[model samples]
Target: PAVVNKIAAGEVIERPASVIKELLENSLDALSTRIDVDIEEGGTELIRIADDGEGIPADELPLAVTSHATSKLRQADDLFCVQTMGFRGEALASISEVSHFKIRSRTAEDHVGSELAVTCGERSDIRPIGCAPGTQIEIRQLFCNTPVRRKFLKRASTEFGYISEQFTRIALACPRMQLSLTHNGKSVHRLPATNELTERLTLFYGSQTVEQLIPIEAEHGGVRLWGYVGHPSLNKSTRKSQYLFLNGRYIQDRSLQHALNEAYRGLLMTGRHPVAFLFLEMPSDQIDVNVHPTKSEVRFRDQQFLFRLLLSTLRTKFLQSD
Candidate 1:
């Protein structure tokens, strides 16, 4: 069973950045309002995520890392409408299999916290501990048991770059969450809670980019679209500036990319892409997220409808400005 976990861990635990992404999703799923991340040696040495959210019970600490065990889903039908960020339930188990993992949590009603450690799939008894009313998880020696994976890892600087990109996505997606990042004992980013998305936009893209952004929002056929689409003059040479999210979850879909391109085809010059931070909120039943292990890709039931809706939204906005 342990060997099976190690093999399966490879599917989701790709690298240090992968660990960061999964852990952040768990924190968000817990309804965390404030999250702090600390990384060392590009997260291969240590990755710590602390969140002020509802914590787990003392007894459930062990079940938290159990394979295929999750609180988000009760039946097979629950997979169709997963609203939480970490639903697969295999993430924590997968992460623990490849790394030295420990989770300490304390609920508001509990007088003391509970701490549990699972190192390389070896479970340790839950112990009583003292902590604040929240949860904190730490990962150390990631991929240490898998020498091949460790060898394939890039340099610390390059790995941290990937982690930074992941951080940027989560921070942007939840701008209202108080988020902070620290690398190698140095503070990299500290974003305060805010109601406006422009603050985060300016922080990430600069004042010039924010000033040129035009608000775009509307609802059609039960799908709500909101976010900023850059002016044609504010185009970029690459799609790196195009950030798309569905129901608050980041996704990479070719159909949506095509819709974006079709919307800006004549507006942008060849090889140029428009900057957009667009989000689509639709009924969870309308999409299927089980297509990927990491849930980064989704399949829409009526994809053409989404494609046309996106294209029309941008094209109409552009036409209005003209």
Candidate 2:
């Protein structure tokens, strides 16, 4: 249905940062070692992302922005066993629906790459362009066609904060990927590829915050969680610093949050929130990521069991000084 495209677009590209997140994921999936993001006015006016990765092929250029055209997975079974960060392939199509979009992609084999432009899901131009051996996408006037969605956006500074936070999490997950962020031509963050996870954390959270982080690892009952958690003394005044990734996929689960809160019950003062970057790995079939449109929330078959395990492990780590 024609309406389904618009609905899919709404799910894939909710806001500027949501667009930014999907594009960044594509760059990472492309095996890009370096990604540079440049934004103007919190990515509402303009957002440019450049990545030095294996670019899209010439023949695949048109399909890149077509609805449901994805190279991430092939069959329905793949959906039940997704290992990559993004698989729906709806990102580009959705992005094109709300903004002025342009993509310049060149694989290493192709002598020249193609450039395509679309405004509100309508293609205006598609031609060959001489570019480097990589992909560079530029999005402008996000949600300009959808005035209602545009109104939901926050202030530029606030939106930029969310964009920056998402970038930080993605970078943390792929420590080997070098990521840089610039706003209005001024560099806000520049992180070169580093093998050390601590360095990446320090670059994002500052040395003091990084110093307060503790490594976390727990495995039992076909589930494994690993990452860093903040010391009780390093609790934040808000829950913004908490990150939970299920099966290498970033997710927001209230049950997991409750488990964390339970673990910190005796250690943290009231109104304090603990900072964490925990990743839970399990069989993909056991967790349903499609439960949410944005793919930020998940449904676990045994959510209670997962919650209790998280709570017990976190509490034991502190009690036993593990």
Candidate 3:
């Protein structure tokens, strides 16, 4: 069982950034208004996430680290309509299987919080303590028990870069949530809660980048698309700046990428890519989020219709701007 868990951990927790992504999703699922992330040595040495959200009860803390124990799913039917980010309940369990994990949480109704510590899937300690009305999780020596997985990690800088990008993506998706990130005791990003997407974009990209963005808003066949796309004059050599969100969740879709590229067919150079931050809103049943374990990729029910809608809407917007 231990070996099986370690193997599954490798699948979900591929790298330090993967751990960060899962934790951030959990925090968001908890309805956290503010999240603070701190990492050291690219999260290999330590990763701590604190959130101002509803905390776990003293008794549920243990089950939280148990495999397949999830609060997100009530029945088999709920699988098709998964609105929460961390549904499988594998993240905490998988993380605890390979790292020194500790969770301290207190609900508003509780006078004191409880802390549970687990090392390599073994319960080391559990105690009641005073804490704020939220959850704080601390992980140290990630993948210590799985040397093979640890060996595959890139350099600290490279790993940290992935972590930072993940942080920015989550922050962008939830613009109303305050987020803070620190690396090696140095502050990397400190974003305040804002209702405007452009304001959040300015914080993530910069004022100069925001100035070059064209606002896009269109609706077709019960789907609404709204976001900012870079002006024709503002092209990038790489597609790193392109970000697409579906129903407030970050996703990567080849068809959507092709639609975006087609919209900019004549404006951009052959090798250059247009920067965009596009958001798609459609009914939950129209798409499936369970296609990928990481939930980064989704499957749409009507691919051709979506492609046409996106291409036509974006093309019209670009033509109008021109």
Q: Pick the TM-score winner.
A: 3
lDDT of each: 0.87, 0.83, 0.88
Q: What is the lDDT of candidate 1?
A: 0.87
TM-score of model 3 relative to the true fold?
A: 0.96
How do all models score by TM-score? 0.95, 0.91, 0.96
For every candidate, C-alpha RMSD to the true structure in Å: 1.7, 2.3, 1.6
What's the true lDDT of residue 322 in model 1?
A: 85
In model 3, what is the error at residue 4, expressed in angstroms? 1.3
Model 1 over residues 1-322: C-alpha lDDT tens digits?
7788888899888899999998888888888899999999899899999999899999898888988888885443344332466747888999999889999999999999999999999999999999998999999999989999998999998999999989988888889999999999999999999888899888788999899998898899999988998998889998778888887778888998898888888887788998999888887778875586475778888999989888998889999998
Please give the ranking of all candidate structures by lDDT, highest first, separated by commas: 3, 1, 2
Q: Give the TM-score of candidate 2.
A: 0.91
| Cα lDDT tens digits for candidate 3, 245-299 | 8877788999999998888888987899989998888887788655765857878
**Candidate 3 or 1, higher TM-score:** 3
Give the runs in model 3 whose Cα sits over 4 Å from its true position.
74-83
